[model samples]
Target chain A: MQEKQKPYAYAKSLELFARAAAVIPEGIYGHQNPAFVLPGACPYFADRAQGGHFWDVDGNQYIDFQCGYGPVVLGHNHPEVEDAVREQMAKGSCFNHPTRLMVDLAERLTSLIPAADWAAFAKNGSDVTTWAIRIAREYTGREKIVMARGAYHGAHAWCTAYPGGVLDDEKKHILSMRWNRLDDLENLADGHKDRIAGIILTPYHHPTYAAQEMPAGGFWEGVRKICDREGIVLIVDDIRACFRLDVRCSPHYFNIDPDILCVAKAMANGHPISAAMGRKNFRESAEAVFFAGTFWSSPAPMAAALKTLSILESTDAIPKMERLGRKLKTGLEELGQKHGFRVTASGPAALPYLTFDDDPDLYHIQAFSRHMISRGIFLHPHHNWFICAAHTDEDIDYTLETADEVFPEVRKEMES
Target chain B: MDEILRASLFLKAVLPLMEDLVDFDTIAASAISDKRLILQFEVKNGPSSHLRIEGGKIRHGIGMHQSPDIRLTFKKPELLNRMFDGEDVRPGLRKGFFHLLFLIREFPKLAERLQYYLEGDGKKAVDEKTKNFQVRIGLHAMLGGMATVASDDASLRSIADETPFGTLLVRILPDGPFGTFTKLSHNGGYIFESTFNQPVRHANAVMEFAGPDAAKKLIDGALNAVTAIGLGQEIKIRGLLPLIDKASIFLYRFGKIMGV
Candidate 1:
């Protein structure tokens, strides 16, 4: 039977899957992680990858939107990057002693991002964000840290805990202020001026659910002037959105520079790495700042990141993304209109979002996300999709085709 | 625990670990006086749940009646099947399988309570409750999970003697997270934080409330402003507490003139 054969063709995957279940939880790598790729299950495994694509052991070729989740801007196994790695392999990758590459990387970052003059590195974003907070306390002799309402900086308890339960009373140093609410910003800075250490915000905006409503009017400018006036340090976490958007996803994007700014993701293209950059004056504080790690300073990411930056310097990487972002947005909106839905897209990054008008009963956004997944184009089911540079125009067209088909079906369902 | 709830059928907590289940016949014979509420479901055994409200308290009653102010039923087989299958209750509501049959107007308050009880803490109900609280947080009329609270151990002991929120949460104190937070103002300016898995009727999306604490604060803040403690007057109180996730407490004000 076709059904039996279809499963039997998948029988090899199935047997491994069953064996995995006997030893592992639900037979998966990540708990609660579902595989939404071809064969429509959690991926059994991947064999190898190259040039904008990868395959599982089953030999399925698909465009990689999973992009190691926002790090594969240059795609899998880029030759120049691979070459950099091979060369670095000849030189010792990491030493407890300082390397010329660290300073070289810092100088390169300071030139690209306005606020990043002196820099520190972390294995991941959470470390740098936490370091930024500590630096804020050091820079200003204050205790409290304020975050924009609904913004996520990292998984640290300070950031993780928001609203009520996220931070218990004991971890009471954090406060939530309206992202663009100038009045709240003014009040917070004014009220806690004497004791407020800093206010950190992710310029990516609309943090929760990635509803990217850009900062409005004089909100950022007002906060900029307020933080200075109140002596509050400003920390910008641009880790995930850095190379995806622009190095200018920093305060420079909003015409202001932060006291400290952190960057990671896409810098190494699927290698686990992140960097923190701050003003020159904060450089002295960095000597006292004690963030340590083993794998963070590993050679693979260092080599990969060196190559990533080289390619970025060579090409108009951010500008090319801007054009592609615009193209994707225009296409998605047009498709949404034709298919009878509303779409929200932002920035010229690999990730642009396509969402419907807000409706409670009909979570059209969720439905659309599920639809995109059912097709080969797997995206983060979100309002703002992270678009990697690897996604070709053909990929976007296929996604559009799927959207066109899905919308009419959805509309019919809504009518019934 | 409040005096009334302690007096009610709240003794199961003290039994030895192995002797978990309670003998309802013994509890009913000791606690009841005249009648019982009918269990309408053919499975849970009908006409079994009964209680009498007097002076402002609820207690078990003798005998069984087909009709009562409140009657809740469960199909034993269906419940067992669901339990055995480990089918989570929240999804079943979203799928629209369960039904609550009732006469809407016969007992208004109790019907509303039953609605809250049955839908309990499903996602939709808890979400609705959360939305309601979020939108109306600044207002004192509805609970916003933020209550103005005060800690007067003596007052909490005396005042929350009958309220359900006070009843279950009164005595057993948690050493971590929430400890001795069993007091709330009935209509107080109170603030507390809670999150429901999903909004279900009477299911708390966010549990923090400024119930009795707010009530007391408002009344004490300006007693001349508080004349009649009725529907819109705001009953500033002692403390009313919140029940945990899987458990719920039943609190009913007494007499025809109670809520008003």
Candidate 2:
């Protein structure tokens, strides 16, 4: 049995957290909240991050698998992307007028993404997703939108996870259907008919804290058929799963084409940029819709995106991430067998979520995550962990070794 | 004049317009046809007068209805007039003259219809351009009112105080129709600065929405701010996660006081 690791010290983090809590509600909000993670295990603040690694304010180094909540696709501070950003920053980061890099990035995306003939840029995933919906509504002259029941397209009123501040009237135009249930989507499209503007979905079902479910066989085809027959726009929100699954697009990886594609998160290797790409049919309507942001045309992020895309296209980043993820998954499974536990890992090899078979309240998974954190590896208990291109074979070997050591501890905690 | 007389006079002046704006089809669709809302008037030194609205019609009488589903009490007729005049009624809420109670879920739609009747183009109160101007002015006032309320309200102050020192810039898009943005800074207290130009420093959070209409919908609670953020509809937010939540809460609180 491996010796029990010392409790991760968080004195500086705790002090910072106290100061943050006094000045900020809940200290850190959204998915980063300490409540979401093992409360006393993870650091509240990060000091710096580089390839496949980040350090906490308390000087604790972690082999990061969370990848800044799915943004750091290549790695933190990727040299190429940073160089591009630096070059653009010297010229000017943003301007009163649009920069040439915006056009370059847009052209690059349209060429790379199969369904994209035209593209529009925005700052976040929500911006592009909402723009897609608005364009769909404008194009179809329809009010109703259909979406997967639990799919989070973005954090707007039409599809927010939380509805505390939303109005019924705002949501009146929106409808929901079960993911991977073609019949449910067909029924809605048939029932709503020409009133339906669009049907938006992720390439796969990856709801939070749950095992991800790929689309049922022929589910995407059926959805495409329904949207085509019903004259409804098909939107793919590939914000989280983009680039990791495939270089072209997640939909392309699954052998399907969406009418509108929303891409962000990993697109620029942690840069703040999202794109709404659409077929030629949506060009007129997309132009008709009023969408503009003060910083949307910024050159630095666009240049970083251009460089990130170039690296992804030229390198074996995606394949490497997937391979490393598989190694981690296979290693954990072997450790689970050795420790008399059933570890289940799901989703794409690149984006994996781990859980114990019988862990309902996620106690075992939490213990496992705490152990991982203590051993200098960072993986989320309730969220899908990302594998970046920067994770090397040595990193994978070390992670597997740590996992092998921690499995017995996890089993002991579970038994206790 | 006595409170009852004042209330009765205002009710008589506004009831016809309110009735015209009712949209019974919407109410019926809302499944609130059976529900009754009591407009209770707590007059100063006078007998209270109440109007019961149910089944898509308004009936005037006191103690005629039992167990009102929603109750809106007005202490002064002037406050009621201010609401009718499309002025910010948040001050009334702060001053304790106006109060509303109902299912929090139902409040948004109710607020929407009430606003349509109150500030909406009722029998051509003003020309199209003037109406547009008034809408813009109203939005500015609401933004300004939020800053005022944030400064005074203890809960809001605590939220501001607790928020990691940062500034939230809310930019209303489409420079022509409603060209303004409000910057909310939380260092120790809160400071709200409204301007058209971009701020010098990168704000902790930036919430962008399409136009005044979208902004109004959000302010009046017809549009869900989080949903807007999610759907990318007319709104977008980018910032520190905690600051985003704090800014959302601050906006929601402001909306609540505005009777949205």
Candidate 3:
């Protein structure tokens, strides 16, 4: 890691952020909000991006492990996804009727995912997740929906992680079960009885400022059994960990069958499209549910999804991403040990988060992340980091190399 | 606006923050350092609380104070709330006339000073001392007001009804000015407990400002939470963050109550 003569600065990024603040809400809002990362220490805006890396407005380049917060699984601007997008755009994008590419993409998903018998398209993860919930409610004629506590399904009023501007009535029917706690889910189902419409859960718990949690042993089996007994619909929100875990969807990796599966990020490799695929029996309910976005029939992202899925299947992208994620995790853990830090690298290899023992407020990790950002490595301090297929051995090595220098400084700061 | 809730807020939350004013504000401290005054606010058929200013310290007592130097009695909770809002709806005097004069003249100044800090009036071109007091008073008022509103307001209570039972800890790092928002399961609402300085413990969620400067910026709304949290160790939030996230809505509502 080359140390700059002067301290690193984001002159242009800050200027643009200030300008954005005057006109925009929170300067940048939602998950993409720069507030989620180290603002002054990290770049607030990107100038351009290519495979595995991006350049900030200040001309500082970074190995971006965030992968656009999980949408860019194949990495930024993959030629195949780009080319397919271009060809479809030339044929025009939004249309009154569904395009052939939409059917092609749906067919591709239904073929790949064992649980998906039919698929519907949307413009975002929230669109499909909300649609899935509504479809389940319509199918069961029940009002209650159970979800894992702290699991983010979407930004909809009923399921939003934040409470700002949301009403109590909007969430009265929504109940929460602790993640990996099969008994909690079972108890919720028992308590709700015939009123449970659906149970929506992220494939894995990837909460912010915390270590990600995989389903404990028999967790999925217990959930399936309970849902089966209660006649409750099980909806898997695989939006964040979709293709990164498996090309066939995360349920396939976990060996759990779900009634409906929603996917968005990494589906089209950065294209703005999402889908909800359900079992054949629920197709009628899915149809009955009113879910429409004007651009749902957009052909370009459909083509992009088609190509992205193909590339994911043809190449060893998934395995490569898993391997790279393992290397980064292993290397980071080793560096933590060498520097007298108790670091735990959590979640599946494809998508990982790092947490320090005894640092509940994440001071050490934030400090480490600040050091990493100044060294031009973009590992988020709070959120789970995505591993894209485009990240190379060199990128991982450089990241480790940067960490080797950073851990000691962070350790020193902890002591001070 | 529920006048009863507003009255509860004034009696339970807002007036009690005078303790913080004396504890943090040097001028307010010196003004009351030599005084021994016990003033009681009695809202007929509603809430009753008292403020005790004794020897450089202020203590708040709930209900009647046994023997108060002066008692200001409101005909209804609404008049008390109206008086808090600076209306000419004076309370009926129940006791000492000189103490009533103190309440008439000097008490408004304390309330005005508290308003100056809580309402974001002293954010610009202020010295470190003013900023420190502002942050201290603002944090207490915000959290205290949140607890009061969560318990007293019907709309806010519904929001609290769904909030998962947990404790949220908020503090500035390396000591001084810390508070905890604990959602009690039995009550189905949150209670905020803060002290001048104490080590945080047993919190389900924690939001820590790195220093007084960061705390000041966030409390004053000069730096939005997003930017403050993003400032790399400036504001570190961890544990059950959804607990904090949910409670933050009340904190936002507290801002609205303060007219920020």
Candidate 4:
């Protein structure tokens, strides 16, 4: 194909969509996104990717904060990853049964992660989380699992329709609790006792506007105590925050090891793979659950995962990422402070969520998203940002510099 | 500064749909203007007043207040920038920051018009370059048909005399999907409900609607109508502003032009 500048740029994406929509549903793979939420349309195609930048077929480049919805950890198409995948591809991507590499993977993971006495794999986060629930159901023989209010577990039919609707089907086997709050959870927990199988949380709330806030004042420890007392399996849905928090062994970071921990995104370098690492108690039950996919055990992704984890651990990826994240965060805070607007940026080192301090309209999200899109950056008005290993000091500087320039303009649009 | 000019132009393009919904001519005649191009629209129920500028200065036209109504406050440049910048003025008024208050009963029709107005201007949008030129919709209802230009320059290279329906004001759009624009004779003209295809490029055109009822009727018909014809040339609608009813009216007009 002919070379262009940035592929994720909006205009070019639209051009590709004008053609692709003719064939695919909504013109791309998967469900429609906020990009298609507007009266207008989302861009159609991604032309190329390298490191922290991606280009659209129309030749617009962006610093890629979207990070493919939190998966491109080592940056887009790292050469090492590609080389590994290429080499693995030469030997074939998969074999029907468990590969010898799986043994190595499970063994290494058991050693590297504190809570991962046993491990299992799937193609996406949803699979692992769902498996955890299955294990919970079988282990305790409980009919229901407790989910934090607004927590997003995955794309399963049960996970998608959890909140805000009069849902009867998915709500079963899933009791609910509020994140970052001990009282709400304890109140709900008292009523459930042994009927509750597991409490799935995001380390932050999953679905609402208030998602991405960390657990405040030992909330996690309290919840852990509650789960331990009640014999409820605690499942941390770290799929979203896994590598970004610099916690290779995140279950230990908060010093609360849930019985089962599920992680995906940034694990296999944009490759579709998710692993649910657990304590020794539930490994056999997890393996027996009907959690299998034809594309699950690809050697390419296996090799990619091994390489990605190696780099993240070897180069101290999380620390370097945190430095850049701090720079971006500091700049955003300063911009909000300077504008005298209620603006704040929070969340982890890799992904940051910025919003107006007090009053936030969805329009700010839309306006900022479009403003950045037109400027060749794609900002989702919906959720937290995904910062990848590819992001550099220069990239953070440029992004912060852009914020300094644009914040005043956005302020003009604010109510005050 | 975001160009308010682009906002105005976008408003003009969508206004045909609004006109189809409400009798804008009746509403326009009802509103007392300062008799200048700086038109101000005082919506009835809604808490918004729209002002139009012609010579880069706000004089008086749509709903301008010489005493500078706080019921219609003016931050002057800041307000203008925000409007063009795509800010919603409704909440501003609610918060006492926009400071313009209107009794819901006082400006009901005008409220609809205000929504149309804001929807067009796009408070926070940057100006985009239009690919097509402009066209005019001739108004035959008053003064033996006033020729309205879709853009400042209204020109048609070719128009299809025969529509699928009846004797109608068939405007040949500048460009369309098939690289052609057709002004088809239909069951109804700009007043009747119809459909039109959206062109890739912006086009300016003049429309000719007979009466207020025709405009409103055209809007209602188009809402239920499911037809679309393509604009063959670069054409855009101009000389129109957002009127709540105007948005509904444009839907039909756009629908009819595209064979809706």
Candidate 5:
């Protein structure tokens, strides 16, 4: 519980940020925006990362739990994944046609994922999700799609996190219903009938800045039933939660089969590769849909993915991460109780979230997160924390002990 | 008749159908009650018309109204016809209905409602079956919610040996309409034994829904449970404090099952 004496120095990072701002739109763009982290505590840039820890630009070191917003499931610079990528890079990255590695990876995916009869590669989660939607539309000859409201599919026009540039016409074909609402989905399907092409959703609702929600009992089963009855394609967007939940497939853990499964993030353990795996029924439409990217057929990420999947299946990586995550969750809950605070921990063990039941504005959470960051632990107040296989028991223990120490400071800040 | 008058007459003809299809009382309870909505329809090279809706009533007239709540200017009669025909209206909007911002903004729901009235009996028949489906599935959700509320009831504890932790009694009060007693028992992860006309005797917990329609909406995913309990004020739960949280989890899970 002893606090670190050194305050985080960000002079070098601030200088780099100013230089990047002159050229880059917001200096550091996307999710890595400095505004997303504590204004002063978190460094603006990461110099390098190894194992379960990362160092910021100013040479400040911390145990990283964000996992690069969900890639890096095994850890930063995993030897096997890196070695595979290195081998592939030696030959080449991309070509006019896909390399043999593409076929190998596709075969591997089909062998593992229950729904995957055919596999198509892409560069990001958005690419695969958008392609899956297109395939659904082509297969069913339907225009409308149903998605859970607030579910982050990707940064596509159909389901963008931001609405600045997206047009109304872009979202016209998409209909939204509350997550885990079986009745609503049924009504929507019944009301729309043959017009609905597909219903896409995450395995669970994990919206930003809120408590993550796990699927309730019979929820996935009911969804499968409705999709089967309605003849609408069921799409599981497991980009963020893949691998972390199950080695075979995330949907397998839920025991519900989807027609199309979209995966990314941890597939190659930080490689820029994504895939849309479809059932046999969707084979024709998947072929017909015009889904192609230049770098999509690159062998490097696919090579990494093959190695990563093989390692994941062979080793105790997922189980160890789950154990570590559970330990962290239990310790946080106990600490919350001791501090006379009601804490809500949700989602799967490997991907968990901690939030104060009573604090909606996240003031205490922000203060506590900042404290954690300052004390060499990288956890986000508004985002679910990730646990990788690289994390050791001592790392988790250090994090918990740090959290216990910071709870009082958080309480005092909230009181003030 | 002029184009405006003709359109007005069409609106009047569909008023009854709208009433039959939409539950105004329920809509009023949730939203859109005692509020005035004016829809101005503009036609190119033709007369314009305005429709006024207030408190579940509809009236239409020729010419435009200033500062209308929603203004829809159709560039072509075919576009409006396609909307009334329940055809996908996006094509029409993209074709030239740029001025019809509200229609474009709302899209299918507004156009689809008009199509529902236009399609007449076929649509009604399908809607009736959908409503029935809603009721059937909704009943399950109601039972589930009630079971959660009464998880720790003495009656539930008595039957816990037989049904385990999941036991429920749904009592539809006669005050609103469609009063009936249903007993739901869970065995081996599946729900079994739904007995009707059975009294609340030997049941773990009891839940009262305002009416069958309310229950249908609640279960149909048309109405949120929390909103039904809070704003709608239609469902009443009587159970143990600790059991309430447990019931909420059950109800939440069941609601997801019913809706998803």
Candidate 6:
């Protein structure tokens, strides 16, 4: 028997969102759109965050599991990362020329990533991803690029999941293969032949509103073989799972060698920075491709990234996140069973998601998410929930306790 | 905008909406309650459609009727399109001069009323009944418009051709209106086989608006489709989302074509 808890209210957040809606498009846009959450059941805005927790505008506190959709890996407003950012900001961020910090970060990435001999900086995952595609095209002197269907590389025209404002011309040269299907990849590569410039894929499939999938056995090996034989570049878009999977990068974690790698999200612990790292063979092609943004040379994020990487390397945060994530997943599944619901927790422990076994319409999971949010744990209903290094055993215990109370309520409501 | 697509939408989508308009709107239904006539409008060597009005009900379909009481012929597709677009273009009457005159005199009022409701102009004081009528028609129009454009427009036809065989079910929840668009076949083309007012047992995608207000906001531009969908429970889009996403883009292009 568990005591029912009062749901967190969002009067202030709603008030602010109403004001925001009049002026801003969709009140909050992109991945953080309030509509992505159970709007009335979840807070629409946040006031402040620290470590693994954040307080909403209405002053209700939550154990943050979303981690700003994979960006706040080290944690929100981490003191060390912030201090590094401040130290760089003291000497100005953007400048007339490339900062020394850029070279240092590049060198650090090139040294750390086994396949990367050089790195170029950018401001977003999309910037580097689109740039990496161009580099592959330049290197292979081809037009078509193959990607796993439903894999999100970025908001760029070539890979945006949404169809708004995108032209068929932009996607004409792009091809798709089903994830974890070596047959699909082989067929696409065989079908397109020398016309394919590259095959871009994430370390694992993390499509929204569905269970995440790891690379099946020999899937990566088959892809690597196909790329080598077909003269196509192998690009690993590790933006969502970069540091969370491995300190080196996801490719290193999975033991797959890629010619080009795009890293972002957790790169600078929430700072705006991304890097496209590539092998020495594509160096001239990378330079030949025109890729530049106004904020590409900014130094503050580079400093933060350097410190973040240092902390990731020097500490046992990666293993800690994994251990905590495992505990949470096990506890959640057990609780779901105890309450007569079959829950399936999928993906790597560090970046986990759970869905009801037979709830394709997602009604049960959505009700479950609303219940969890009511209990002050911020797990997204649609996307995979991130487990930051800041999360601890106490947070996991509290989450499990809340889910224990929630699972019954969700089951009862859904059954009704 | 392509003239053929526009003409197709006007013939297939817009004209078809008159059925729901008469069924839902008391004024539109009463206006023709005593009337029973078949009015056919055809573009010379191009698209043609006829509307049947009987027993206070309106039903429309593509191509000519066997024996229409009234028939009006347009020299070209643009003439019919411009006529629907509110230009004062008159077509040559081939039959039933009195019936054609009756349509010419009575049809504009019905069209204006339909536009007022679909656009949610807020010019007139709206009751719950009228508002519901507006939402029902808006959903039908957008979906019918999408099906028409997806089948006819070159861009959307290519998309439709690429779209795998599947069905998209859209409904205003807790009762009332429903629309289902099915990609009947790959090269066989698409059909907006709307099982309106009926719940589909299964579909590749199901986009449910929580209530009429949510549906109204989405249809009237008070809320964007993506934003409404983001509201999770307010608007639930589940299952094969790519089909819904592509259908939304077709609906968007249809709205652009309609200039509303």
- Chain A TM-scores of each predicted structure, in the order given, are 0.85, 0.96, 0.98, 0.91, 0.97, 0.97
Clashing pairs in 3: none
Q: What is the per-residue lDDT of model 2 for residues A1-416, given as tens digits with 9 covering 90 to 100?
A: 22335457777876776666656655666667665565556777899999999989988888899999898999999988999899989988768998888788888988898999999899999999999999999999999999876577777877775545676677788888878888888788778878999988999988765678888889998999988889999999999999898999799899887999999999889989999999999999999999999999888888888998899989999899889999888888888888888888888899998878875545678788888888788988878999999988888888888888888888887578
TM-score-wise, the better of 3 and 5 is 3
Q: List the global CA lDDT of all models.
A: 0.50, 0.71, 0.82, 0.54, 0.69, 0.84
Q: Please identify which of the two predictions, 3 or 4, would achieve the higher DockQ against the true structure.
A: 3
RMSD of each: 17.4, 17.7, 4.3, 18.0, 19.2, 3.8
Residues B61-152, model 4: lDDT tens digits: 22234433333333343453344344645322312223232322213444455344323333443232110111112121110111111111
**In model 6, where do residues sit more than 4 Å from their true spots?**
A1-5, B23-50, B62-77, B88-132, B146-195, B199-248
Question: What DockQ class does candidate 1 belong to?
Answer: incorrect
Chain A superposition TM-score, candidate 6: 0.97
For A206-297, candidate 3 gives per-residue lDDT tens digits of: 98888999888889988999999999999999999998888998999999899999999999999899999999999999889887778898
Model 6 per-residue lDDT tens digits across residues A1-416: 11344587778877777677678887788777765566567888889999998889988888899988888988899999999999989999879899899999999998988988999999889999999999999998999999987788989988876556888898889888889998988888878878999999999999887899999988899899989999999999999999998999999999999999999999899999999998999999999998888989899999999999999999998999999999999999899899988898899999999999877767788788888887789998889999999988888998998898899898788668
Q: Model 6: what is its DockQ?
A: 0.31
What TM-score would each prediction reach against the true structure?
A: 0.61, 0.63, 0.86, 0.61, 0.62, 0.88
How many angstroms is residue A108 displaced in model 5 relative to the true structure, after the best TM-score fit? 0.7
Question: What are the per-residue Cα lDDT tens digits for candidate 1 across B154-222?
Answer: 222212232224311211011101112233354663323222122233221112223433323331232
Model 2 lDDT per residue over B18-81, tens place: 3333443265226345556665543343333455667866554433235443345556656665
True contacts kept of each: 0.00, 0.00, 0.30, 0.00, 0.00, 0.18
Could you give me the TM-score of model 4 versus the true structure?
Answer: 0.61
| DockQ of all models, two decimals each | 0.03, 0.02, 0.32, 0.02, 0.01, 0.31
Candidate 4 residue-wise lDDT at B140: 14
- Highest lDDT, which number? 6
lDDT (tens digit, per residue) of candidate 3 on B1-260: 56777787778767878887887767677667777989989988878899998888998866789989988899898899778877778789898787755776677877776777776554367778777777776666666777776666666654666565666778877765787776775555344443334455577767788888988877767777765554445777765554666677777776666555
Best prediction by TM-score: 6
Give the interface RMSD values of the models in order. 22.8, 16.1, 4.4, 15.8, 19.9, 4.1
